[model samples]
Target: MSEAPFNLVYLGIGTVAWGVAGLKIRAWRRDPSPGLLVVALTIAAPATAFLVAAPVLYRLIDRVAHRGNLATLLVYLGITGFSAAAVVLARMWTPPKERGDAQVWDGATADTWHEVRRRLAVFAVLVPVMTVLFFTGGATAPETPLTFDTTFATVPQIALFLVLYQALFGFALVDISRVCFGHASRLPTGPLRSGIRLIVLGGLIACGYVLCKLIAIGAAFAEVTGTEWLSTALGPGFAALGAVLITAGFAGPAASAWARRRRDYQALRPLWDLVYRADRRLALEAPPSAWTERLAFRDLEWRTARRGLEIRDGQLTLRPWADPEVVTAAALVARRAGLDDEDRAALIVAAALRGAAAALNEGTAPRPREDQVPLPGLDAGPADERAHLVRVARYLYAPLTGEALTAAATTTG
Candidate 1:
């Protein structure tokens, strides 16, 4: 594709991906994981450049500097984002107690961080010089006609300067990627695992661009001609590939979370149906009977929260029907069967609910007792609510729990 079409596609896709990653980062910031925040900022830099700066704003600089102005913006953005990525990678590579903030360069290298600062101080001075040299080194003649004066861009020192900058940048990109991929390899097939891998892949591709530029720099110093295509086409193609992958990587966690919520919401449906019907007032909205209501997958976090909320509410309403003796009686049967703690919880709930269902069917509202064997709602904290409910659902669905309840009932009789 031509420059206009290519830029538009890249800008369009990059803007949307970066925007999604930004929202995910913002949500994470509510609790503020320092490592995640650093990674978010790292993602934000490129998103800002591709969406905000490169697509159009670079034109303002091009008015004076002409051709290489957009590249200058890229270099600055790479510097900022890469530096943050380095910090995040370093923080993640270390143990938990070691990571203080990971948002700053100082946090990454801590005892040796002043060296990073000293280099940054020097970099602050060199950036302006490099930007000036890049623009002055000149551009390929516009395929159509003259917008600015076409100066020969084979300046030896300038080529070497650009090459050195790019080489160091490639080194950073690849370094962080190594650490990220190292950790990602150990993770299971999940969003976080996949995200890290994608980011690493992007970094590796980006390193190809930097390496190509470095090679072009060598040719420039050798006074050779006819390799501009390496810098122009190959380098940027790799760069585009890298940007797309990294953006997707940043978006992985949120997408994964949403998928999990959708799955869990559906998985709990059977139990939800039973308990909600037993106490219709427990539901937040109207009955989740409508097709749209049951299948709507948006607002997952809130839905997940409400699931736990209504579940606990239902469990509380079942309190009066909960048979303490059944829970106590089931514990003995569970012990004799060598059930673990989790299985014990499941069977206890199963046995009590069985007895409760029997009494309720006979048109008897069983009286509540103070010692109710802690049926399900006592430990209904937000963090583990989903897990708690899933256990209940598992027991409710399995015929084994019903059998366990029958055995307990027979033993009690």
Candidate 2:
């Protein structure tokens, strides 16, 4: 009884399988959507159960009880749970009125009477079929748990078990296909959309298992019988690969959103830096270095909001020196360059900011004109302000804008 080296393959699968369970747990805690709950349970429960029971299923069967337990727990429960999850997803996204008469899904989704009865029929068939194999005596199946051709090759029981198992899988996958397609077709471009696509890809990959199984079943039926490897080897391999892909897909949306925000935060860096350099007093805290900025992934929206605030503050402090002439000159150059209205406004603001900063730096800024009425400072809500600041930032680093600012500084001087 040499201990089989720890199955690294199952170890990897177990990691994803448990992580998915955690997601389901979190979704339940957040919204308590029963449809989502059912989806979580159906996927997470069977996967966890299968992994836990693998050790028992992998060994040679020497008992009268559960001669078909592998078929029951692994094959049957796998179909049952996943099918229920598909139904749940379909109901969640698709409108009730749109769900046709072909399948009736109750508000609870997976528990619809139609689905229940159908699953019960399969269960009813399995109970008798599994019981009929006692006369064959105890069997020694080869390595790689479940679907061993040699274990019950000559027995009618194996054929019935395989048939029921495949039928159940086919039924479940049909609903799963509906959910995946519905999600892919309808969800707008976002993390959720991408996540659904990953699930769809994973489902397709997992379908390979069925294809391999069908090939093996066909070979058995034809009595040519040399392709057991298709079901025993290729089927589970595809299933494992699909599991990994599905897990990744489930996480895709959240991950994508996180990445998107991080990108937006990073994108605003150039402008944020300019505001800090122009008026250090406006900044609530010292700016982080470029390397630190790159690494700062958390609270990005808050940081960006603060950056906008400081940019507005910097403009306020520079207002007494706010030359309408700089705006006028900047506008002329921008218009000649064929800048759009938004770009025109942004470039004018950029030129004004650079001139003010340069004047304070040069220490030769002219005395404020007492008679000229001061233009209003940047007065807007944070969101609108942020948008304008981002625009200004865009032109801040441009060579053309730098030249314009230098020219504007000379004019002001």
Candidate 3:
């Protein structure tokens, strides 16, 4: 197989790792959660491994260090670090609700710390042993970085080194695969569950990659010729494909979540404007301009949440001026017009809010407590409320809503 394809794969994986790592770093700066830090390491470690393993960087590192095959040591270290990080992440995993339970949280935290210590201890012992074994095993080999495993397998020291490294790597892959598969199976159908499933699948493929390398190494040590192709082509091929899937798996839920927040933030704009215009004091801070808001990408979840809160505050501030008669009238008009439940609710809320905004603007006397229009999602949870508010915002300028408002006014007149 051409080294070109493998080089491209390594490069692509490294690029994705850096991109995702940047996002993870930014998020950690904002939240600084332990899990987030581990997640970032999980990506950065493999990325560094692949980058150093790439033909160009492999040669550069070896040349710079004045040691042949030093890149191989670094690559193994990177892989081992990734395995440790992944296992730690799986051990620390907990549902959102369980994360809030003090007992469960404490237990998980303690267990995670213990696991971290255990893995660090293993690294301290195994890393130096692997390094000493690699250097003492052999001097310089003419084979390229891509074929180092097959070429060095005949040397007892190097073979032992490969065996030790693959043992830890394989065990971590199997452990994480099992945990991720179980968690994914129990998770409700969603982006998160799908992401976990992909990770599980990637881990299984990586296990295959490890198995292939070991098989080729054993064959080479047994004086078998031509098995180098397994290590050179088949093994690395599995690693490359597995890396792609794992990267995509991590990116999927995060990208989808960010997109959803962006959509919600944009969707709430008209409703935010309506409320802001009625009472600027309701805004927690000066609002961003339209273009700036549209272009803003960082902290989207926080921004969307804050924007929703501000809109709700504005609604509360204008509640005294809201007229229940308008909502009732609009609902009747919408029903007679045969709109669906969702559209009818949206149109009714839109008409009520419009009347409230106008009344607040005109300095009209506050309505009696009994006549005040209650918000549609007063009792809803945050997510349901946001969805309901987005619906109303969509219809805020709809022709049907405008017609309903006018008809309600005529009927109440």
**Candidates, ranked, lDDT:** 3, 1, 2
Model 3 C-alpha lDDT per residue in residues 90-136, reported as the tens digit of each score: 77777544554311112256767887788768877988999899999
Could you tally the backbone clashes for each prediction?
A: 0, 0, 0
- Tens-place lDDT digits, model 1, residues 293-346: 567777777776787678667676776777666777677767877888877776
Each model's lDDT comes to 0.63, 0.62, 0.82
Model 2: clashing residue pairs?
Answer: none
List, residue by residue over 1-413, the lDDT tens digit for candidate 2.
Answer: 22232245655576677777777677578767556566666568546644543545334232434354343334345555565556445545544355542111225445454565665566567645644543242333333354554345445666655565666565556556556766476555766767777777887787787788877876776676678878766886887787777777766765665675576566667766666776777777887888998888776667776766666677766655556676777777888899887777778777776666666666646446683324322664554655666677777667657767667668858
Q: In model 1, how large is the Cα lDDT of residue 151?
A: 19
Better of 1 and 3 by TM-score: 3
| Per-residue error (Å), model 3, residue 284 | 6.3
Q: What is the lDDT of candidate 3?
A: 0.82
Return whichever of 2 and 3 wins on lDDT: 3
**Weakest lDDT window of 10 consecutive positions for candidate 2:** 100-109
Which candidate number has the best TM-score? 3
